[model samples]
Target: MAATKGSLSINSENIFPIIKKWLYSDHDIFFRELISNGCDAITKLKKLSLIGEYEFKDDEESELKVQVIANAKDKTLTFIDNGIGMTAEEIDEYINQIAFSGAEAFLEQYKDKTNEDQIIGHFGLGFYSAFMVADRVTIESLSYKEGSKAVKWECENGLEFSMDDCDKTDRGTKITLYLNDDSLEFANEFKAREIIHKYCSFMPVEIFLSNPNAEPEYDTIPESEVTDKDTVIETIVEEAKTEEKENEDGTKEVVEVSPATTKAKILKRPKSISNPVPLWTKHPNECTEEEYRQFYHEVFMDYKEPLFWIHLNMDYPFNLKGILYFPKINTEFESVEGVIKLYNNQVFIADNIKEVIPEFLMVLKGVIDCPDLPLNVSRSALQNDGFVKKISDYITKKVADKLSGMCKTDKENYEKYWDDISPFIKYGCLKDEKFCEKMSDYVLFKNIDDKFLTFKECLEKNKEAHENTIFYTTDPVQQSQYINMYRNENIDVVILKDAIDQPFITQLEQKNENVKFVRIDAELTNTFKEEVNEDELKEMTDKLTEAFKKALNRDTLDVKVEKMKDSSISSMITLSEESRRMQDMMKMYGMAGMDPSMFGGAGETLVLNSNNNLVKYIIDNPEGENTDLICKQLYDLAMISHTPLNPESMTAFIERSNKILEIITK
Candidate 1:
């Protein structure tokens, strides 16, 4: 055929620029798009071979693969695939026409005869992505059909193209990209390798990256080390090494301990950079614990071992296979951005796509490959479709099922991983209602005794002490005083230290209306108080409150006097649960500037133990010389126990403590 030139067939004159802007914001994605087109070509050829429509010549390359070559000296990046190529007419029909997909056409023609699970390109715009980074693009292709002639096509600025017959005799296709000034970095060998590793690490076909301008690197290996998938450049022999050794009984002998010594051959083995088959594609029974760990490490590059993993494999309703790893995260769950890589037919689409991955699952490291994903034109995001919701719901159900199953069958390991995995489960509960319902029974709480128990177990165990009330401590060390009081009464208190626990407990309370979560310092229940005459107790409280108010010099201070069974306790602080929750909600919503006391009397009440010696002395000598110092010291001590004391208050307490020490010494 003679050389022919024409403009690209498209409706809009500025389509190319629109494609450059809208197809993908990341220009480097052109690498993924072009390579995906190559994979699709190979997949089409494989379908043809399977149905006997095409035959591979004995001398041709049998193993299908994609090769990427970066030539820095020429400022060009090339992609070569030894799969089905295109004819002249086919190129005109597919390449000349914008938004026309060759892969989709081939699949339609062979719809009944072939399985289209491995086809990666569906949008038909993948080939045009090359224009995003290249100044010019060229295509050289020779079809697999017999008697087909090789064709060459070139396009510059994506507006006009020229086609002609070429002398090249390659069986497949070769695409060369002339890197633009801004995209010159893609031509660097290291940069090319990095891009390929990012997108093609789990492609169905093996992908190899090379630098043609650099010196060829050769490695020597034995002949037996070469597999059918390896490419051998040359073979060489190995010299044998013989050493004389003494036997155990004192006899000296020369033995051939090295098996391949005399007959070994050095063979060159070329390795691909990608794994054609990832761990998720296999059946769960065929995988081991070590293999799961290895796959997690390889994909996530996280050295900390995962707590556990859920292998999702379903064929009916929709084909979805994945491995969701519960990573051992070091930071807060809200701040964590878990890497849940989404894939379509083993081709990476994006990470943490909320349309296909439940919002809560984003805090997990895993891979989900659904060949039936409904991707938009760019193949970068999911189209608004109901199918995507089914996938997300399926993943959420699978995770909830796995956790509940583990709690039922493997109680020990479930408890062992509960601390690290609780935040994730709690987050899921807060975000997803169905997941919360499914995981409600499996939630574990760690008590002050360092033992784990479920909500039901906690309620049942503490029914006699505080019915339907779950008392928890936020800071175990700082709240140890109140914890000891509860411990003295044999009342159980669970630890809820994480910020997530605030909303989580609230959710639990809403779900189970009868259940309540109270902070340990929220109230001094009757269980901790001694039975005394009401009139006498009321008179004592009135006198003590007046005396404390006069000494502390604060007229607005909330004071409560209680005769406690623990006489050693002098004073403590208590805040109403409603007031504290309101304050916490305000802070959570970023309204820290608002006065929390406006919602309720959020200011804590100073609880004075009437049985303590200090309270007795203060009530007896309200106007004594040292009464003011002792009352202020007791109030500071209570403040320190409730929360950290302010710097100024701490200094005053230190000075008052020294004065008391001086009085004691005198």
Candidate 2:
């Protein structure tokens, strides 16, 4: 045939520049686009073969694979795929037309034959993405049909093109890119491998990267051991070897040191960078825990083993397969941000796609491969559609079901992992209402006794003591005193240490109207008090309130005198649960500078134990010289117990304690 030359079948001359600059967000994405198209071609061939339309010869290269050959010296990168090659007329129809997807067209034509084959390309524009890095591109393809001649198509800057019959004999397409000066890095083998691993690590087709300019390497294996996919260079035989050795008893012995290899063949096949069939694609029962952990480590690079994981395999509503890992996150050290890789037909699209992965599940490290996702043009983001919401809802439901199921069936392991996974569950509850409702029953709280208890179990255990109220401690070390008081009274206090727990409990309160959460030091309960005469209690409270107010020089200070069972306890600070929550809300919104008094009844109170010697002395002698010093000392001590003392107050407290000690020595 004569050489044919013409401008590309596009209306505008500026289309190439537009595709190079504005079509894709990242230049590296060109690799994914071109590789995905190759995969689609191979997939179409498999479907045709499956339906018996295409026959595979026993001696031919029947293994479906994509080979990426990067030639740094030549400044070229080539993609060769042993798939269904296109005819000259087919190339003109698919390649000449812009935005016309060849995969979509083939799927349309073979709809009746194909059942579950995944076509990666939705728009033919992926081919043009090559212009993002290449100055010129060429394609050599031979149609799989009996007498179709090989066609070679070439274009400069994706504009004017030339087509002619070529000497190619292979029954597949080979695309070569003459990379531009600025994009020459892609021609480096290392860079090519990096790009392939980033986006095509899990592609449906086995992708192998090679540097054609590098020295060729080969391995010799037994002919019987060679697979159909291996490229054989030669076949040879090896002679057996024997060695003479002295036995333990000084007798000479002849032993075969190596066995003779028969029909050995030299083969060259680069290892595939892609795991075509990933762990997520398999049924849960067919997978092992070790495989799941290995997948987590490989995908997220998190060596710290996950607390547990949920393998989602669904087919009825929509095709979705994934493994969501509850990674063991040290919230104190590492960021709680988890990686959820989103994929289409095993090709990674993005990470942490909120449209498909529920926002709450972002703290989970996993991979979701859902070909049914409604991806937009670039496949970098998802289109705003209700189907995406359904996917997100399904993921949230799966997580909740996993947690609730574990709590029911694997109670021991559930409690074992409660500490590591509670923050995720709490954050999920805070973000998703349905998830919160589903997980409420399974949420476990760890008490001071190192025991895990459900909210219902805790409430029922303390029903007679503190009805419908849950007491929690933020810092077990700092609030050990308060916790001791609860323990002395035989009441359980759950530890809510994570920052997420603050909002989580608020949500819990809103959900259960009858329930309320209180910090351990929020108030002095009557359970810790010894019964005293009403008149005597009133007299002591009045005396102490006046004495403390006068001595501390703060008339507005709210003071209470409680005769405690633990007489050694001198003073304690009590802030109402309602007031503490108000303060916390203010801090969260950056209104912490505002006065706590702005919230009505939000002021803190100083509770003096009348049974203590310091309190009795101050009550009896309101005018005593040491009484003033004792008042300041007691207030500072109480402040330290409640929270960390400010620098100035901490300094003052130290000096006052030294002075008190001097007085005691005198």
Candidate 3:
């Protein structure tokens, strides 16, 4: 065919900017798009061969491969694949025509009964993504059809491209990119290798990376597979894989034979930079536990083995396979991105996509390969797609099921790992209502005694004693007095220390009626003493309330006289749960011109233990200096229990304490 020049179909105006900037979210996606195209070409050819539409030579290798070579010095990169290549007319139909996918056409025609593989590219624009990081790109292809002319197509960063015949004799396509100065990093061997390992690590087809600076690598295959004369055979011992047999006699004999050695043939193989058989791609039963752990270590580069893993192999709803690992997360709220590598038929898409991964599952680290996800002309189209939502729900359900199973079968281990994974569970519950519903049963709370109990267990155990209220403490030290008071009464309080805990407790309250989470230091309810008369109780309460109000100059103080369960504690000051949370929010946001002292006055309630002797003395002696001095000191003590006093209050308390000490000494 004669050389011809023409403008690309889509843009009357130059659309290179659109392809470069808007085609993919990341500039590096160009690598995924181009590599996926190569993989697609290989898959299409294999499909044709399987269906008898194309014939394979008896001597030809059965497998197809993709090869990538990057030259940092030349600032050039080449992608080559031995698959179903395109003729001149095919190139014009696929390459020159913007967004017209030949792979889609072939899938439409031949995808009815395809199996064991997937065709990756649906949008022809994937090939044009090369322009994202390239000043110019050239494609040379030889079609699989007999006697077809090898064609070469060249395009700069412009609307027009030239297509002509080339002298390529092999049946494959080679795409070379002349990278621009700003995009020259793509031509670096290390950078290209990183991108390939990120995007194409688990691609079904083998991918080989080559660079001039690196030493050549030779691949050694099994001896049984070698048939070529040029192959150099070697022996590799397989330790721990001995063949054991019983002697002719009844007795067994120990024979120390060298470990089984595999007969191997060596070929100067291109540097294969992909794990063609990813753990997730294999059947779950076939994958060993150690293999799953090793795969996680290799993918994440974490030294610690994952605590456990869930292998998801679903074929029915929409081809989804994944391995989600639960890593030992010693840290939380630390901007750590849980890497759930998303893949479309082993080609890397993105990690932890909100549309595909539930927000709660984002803390998990693993890989999910789903080819059913729809892709259009651009990468941005991936977000908010219906298929993505379904996949996200499926993953969330899988995680919930795994957690529920663990809690049921391995209660001890579940309790052991509860502390580490609880934050993730709580966060998930707060973010996703569906996940919360599924995971509510497995949610566990850690008590002050370091015991783990489920929400229902805690509620059931303390429902009668605490009136269905769950007591919790944010800081054990700052609220030690309150904790001690509760411990004296043999009451257990759960620890809510995480940033997510407040919201999680709020969610539990909203979802579960008749359940309440009250901070240990906040809002102690009133209970009348069975021995004391109602008139005496009311009289002591009014006297103590008037004394504290006059002494602290906060007339709004709602004081209560409660016969204490313990004889030691004389008084306790508490605040409403809502008021305390509001104060926390104000402190967090640093709201100017607002004082916590304003809330301090109205939010506080003083609970006086009437059982203590000091409280009896204050109730009996009303207007004397002894009563006035003790009342001020008791009010300050209760204030200090709720929050540490400021410098002025501290100084006043110290001065008043010294005067009392001087009087006692004299």
> Candidate 1 residues 1-666, lDDT tens each?
888999988735325444555668788888888888888888888788778887777845447899998998999999999889999999998899887788889889988997778888876788888988887999999998889999999999788899999987878899999988888999998998888888888888888888767775666666776667556776666555568999999999987755543222333345799998899999999999999999999988888899999999999899999999998877753357789998888888898998998888898999999999989777788889998898899999999999999999999999999988898899999999999999999999999999999999989877997899999999999899999999999999999998899999998898888899999999999999987788887887787777778877778778888889988999999988887888788888898678777766476899999889998888888778888888888888888888898788888889889999999999
TM-score of 3: 0.81
Cα-lDDT of candidate 1: 0.87
Weakest 10 consecutive residues, lDDT, candidate 3?
A: 523-532
Q: Predict model 2's lDDT versus the native.
A: 0.87
Model 1, runs deviating above 4 Å: 11-19, 57-62, 222-268, 332-334
Model 2, span 1-666: residue lDDT tens = 778888777634224334678788899998999899889888888788788888878744347899999999999999998888988888888887677778888888888878645789886788888999999999999888889999999989878888999999888899999999999999999998888999999888899888877888888888898876678888777878999999999999889989888665555666888998899999999999999888888888777988889999999689999999888888779898999999998888999987888887898889998989888778899888899899899999998998899999999999999888888888888888899889988999998899998889888878997899999999998887898889888888999988888888888888789899989899888888888888998998888788778867886888888889998899999999888888888989998878787777468889989899999998789889888899899988888889999999899899998998999899
TM-score, structure 2 vs. true:
0.92
Residue 305 local lDDT, model 3: 72
Considering lDDT, which of the candidate structures 2 and 3 is the better prediction for this target?
Answer: 2
- Candidate 1 is scored at a TM of 0.93
> What C-alpha lDDT do the candidate models reach, one value each?
0.87, 0.87, 0.81
